[model samples]
Target: MRVLGVDPGLTRCGVGVIESGRAREIACLGVGVVRTPSTDELADRLMAVAEGVEGWMDAHRPEVVAVERVFSQQNVRTVMGTAQVSGIVALAAARRDLPVAFHTPSAVKAAISGSGRADKRQVTTMITKILGLESPPKPADAADALALAVCHLWRAPMSDRIAEAEAKAAQLARNHRARLADAARERGSTGGQQR
Candidate 1:
């Protein structure tokens, strides 16, 4: 499948496009950041990001768009800005009706490095190795975006299976609990005792 991955930010959003399946391969369709001048108003910056993403979508026509999910941290302002950027990324995908998926940082790390706690450098190293590139993609952010796409390629199916399994297990647990409660009530009524 052809997938476009986006690492969204107001000042510099990273983008990467890759095609995979049938064979494990990738073409560096494009990689770069969307930059808006610092002097520009925040609203303008956001608009630029959205426009940039739209342009990429038009050019690449990816079947799916994978984006990193915004993580809330101690810095509320940063979190808010990241959330806005993520929203734009989602909107861009929605505009095209392309399938969109989100990957958490931990999921990306685990997919790339077999460990959720892997550091950025480790993730970068794995990406480079997987792509068989002599050097890492530029601007770190661009590399990260590529990594996110790769992570989704590897993890999306597994995640779906896990979610399905969990849902089934939860339903079973609920049914078992209800049966136990029903049995208890029946026993209480038959005994007709206040014990």
Candidate 2:
């Protein structure tokens, strides 16, 4: 699938595109900060980010967009801003009818480096190695976006398996509950109540 990965930020949203499959082809496409002048209003900054993401969608026309899921942390302000930026990115993808998927930071790290706690350097190194690139993608955010794409690709199959397993488990639990209910009904009909 041709996927566009976005690391959203009001000041600098990182975007990357890659074609993932047996061949594992990657195209950095472009990566740069979308800056809104410091004097600009917050709404303007958000608009700039939205425009940047929309421009990317127009250029890439990707099959799907993968975005990093925002997590609440100690810095509420930063987390809130990131969440807003992420919404803008998601909205851009939805506007184009592109499927959007979110991957958590730990999932991205583990998919790229075999460990959820992997450091930034390790993530960049693994992304470069997996993509067989001569140099790491510039700026940590860009590398992170690429990593998020890779993570989604790696996780998709597993997600299907997990869903199937959960469905089976749920079915089994329902059957067991039905059996218990039937037994209770039988006991009640026989007037054999137990304390």
Candidate 1's clash total is 0
lDDT of each: 0.85, 0.83
lDDT of 1 by residue, 86-118 (tens): 998898798789989998888888988999999
Which sections of candidate 1 miss by over 4 Å?
A: 160-195
Compare the candidates by TM-score and give the number of the best one: 2
Candidate that would win on lDDT:
1
- Candidate 2: give the clashing pairs: none
TM-score, per-candidate, Cα-based: 0.79, 0.80
Residue 186 in model 1: lDDT? 94
RMSD of each: 4.4, 3.7
